[model samples]
Target: MTDGMTYRERARTAAHPTGRVASSPVVRHALGRAHGAVPDPVTVFDDETPAVANLDPELLRALRRAATDAADDGVEFFVNGGWRSPEYQEQLLRGAVSKYGSEEEAARWVATPETSAHVLGDAVDIGRLDARAWLSEHGARYGLCQIYRNEPWHYELRPDAVENGCPPMYPDPSHDPRMRR
Candidate 1:
């Protein structure tokens, strides 16, 4: 359906294919927007977008608490991805497969719908390097912790972390036990 082009290439073409008036709906759907995608400028506090509003309540609360403190230090938390629909997860997996040239390679980056924390509303991908750094240094106090060593932007709530500290991270999604499901 993508004419043998990778998803990124197709996205570029759909966004500006010589005289194209608008982006292709198919591309948008495949990317994220049509499946509970996070809106631009979204923060941990956002409750209007399904991406944020659909997050697990405890996770959202911890994120908000951490974000509020991070803000005082001039670091703002921005949501890059959260609470994805299964269709969106599959689309992303397909794109990853196309980009990485194999399912094994892609698994390091994107999890299958059945194994993805985003699908369960328990994971969030935060944007911006400074925000990630802020979280990296102080997140444990709020029960928020980076889940993967390779994905500094991806976080999850671990209530026990506030006292016991965050557990060791897996090298990547592929090494995560949950991803084996």
Candidate 2:
């Protein structure tokens, strides 16, 4: 499996007509990491990784502000995921479907590429329990709100939250109106 050609051959045979290597998961994952995948935990201050760098400017600013304050409290904010490519989002959805045994169940955890906030660069999945807990407590002040009750690590920008606090969370992605599209 580590040889990489298995994925490439499968991808070519199953999907690509031109024997393209880009469709391979190994290649896609590498390209994803180059573009926006968080292969390793990275702080909001990490500008080199596209995962952090590609976030919506407003969301990025809010995250950085929150991260700076969190650092003072001895809680460092690390991004587990952010700003996924459409292909990456599709891959995640497919994985979820495989793991959950049905698209209906998968929708609870993963959104379609067209509807994914990560693909839109509007959401981020934070790493570390301490960071998530800190964000849960004080993120509203910075306009970062956890979007799904089931996904405490998933945060999105909600500028109104800065003044009025975050709106109620969706039970999961399946419950969100935006995901219906």
Candidate 3:
């Protein structure tokens, strides 16, 4: 672990003491909202697509390099979602429950907002079947890994994966002990 803290611990500490980053103006300002400064540099694939922003800095660099490599092979990575606000993640979880009809089923699709990797800027959801397939085959080279067996589009940075490959995928968020609350 870096700095004697596990990734989860670091993530938890990254949020406000109240466990809500979205409502913390100090955090928002530090993230560059107060002065209208760029919060985080975004990577825009094209004018037609929204940019991907607020990712972990190292992860963002690796992703851009990976995307460049993928482009050479005629596949382009498209980010569907990244670095969600806590409230946005909560909204997603609520929607997931409504669609899936149970908390258990919803957990498979959406994490609790406070504990979500997205809220911690550590996870991303990719769009496009071809991009996902390409990543499934080559993402380890860039230190990216699919963390859940059921969520093929979801990925996270796992720097060790570059040398050892990714750890085994969890069956789903429900099966992940980290999701237990």
Candidate 4:
């Protein structure tokens, strides 16, 4: 099922329609870097800018809607990272390797591209880590889900959409250390 639009194309319409969001004007945009299954730290704006790293465009659409609603009620939020580069994933893998020892061990502890949530371009890294109450209360309305137990900051687009071949619901995480890198 093709969505007939590239990820960049879709992202433009939703978050960066005027391209200002991509710049540091309204939102501080970064090129979606990952570190240990989470987004790399914020590029800037420890406050006010609400980091949104590693956010897939389809997921961004859902998140943007939620952000709009939150803004109405005096809440502030933003997406940080979306699509991550292979290099970024390597940095994340390195972190795991350092924590677990050996590349194989790290692979077990972290996800590879074949099974990465980011591969779907439907997963996102949202911000306001200290305050998830608003999201917890109304995130479902936008079809976004906080699926990862280890990482509450991670959000994914509705899984049922076949456009990206993602399962309707998240698959269980593998804990077998033997299967990791």
Best by TM-score: 2
Write the residue-wise lDDT of candidate 3 on 103-137 in tens digits. Answer: 88899889997678877778878878887898899
Deviation in angstroms for 5 in model 1? 44
Candidate 3 TM-score to native: 0.73
Q: Candidate 4, residues 138-164: lDDT per residue as tens digits?
A: 777666666655556666766443243
lDDT for predicted candidate 4 compared with the true structure: 0.50
Ranked by TM-score, top first = 2, 1, 3, 4
The clash count for each model shown is 0, 0, 0, 15
lDDT of each: 0.77, 0.78, 0.67, 0.50
Best by lDDT: 2
lDDT of 2: 0.78
Residue 140 accuracy (lDDT) in model 3 = 94
TM-score of each: 0.80, 0.81, 0.73, 0.56
Stretches off by above 4 angstroms in model 1 are 1-33
RMSD of each: 13.1, 13.2, 12.1, 10.1
- Evaluate model 1: give its lDDT: 0.77
Model 4 Cα shift for residue 79 (angstroms): 3.3
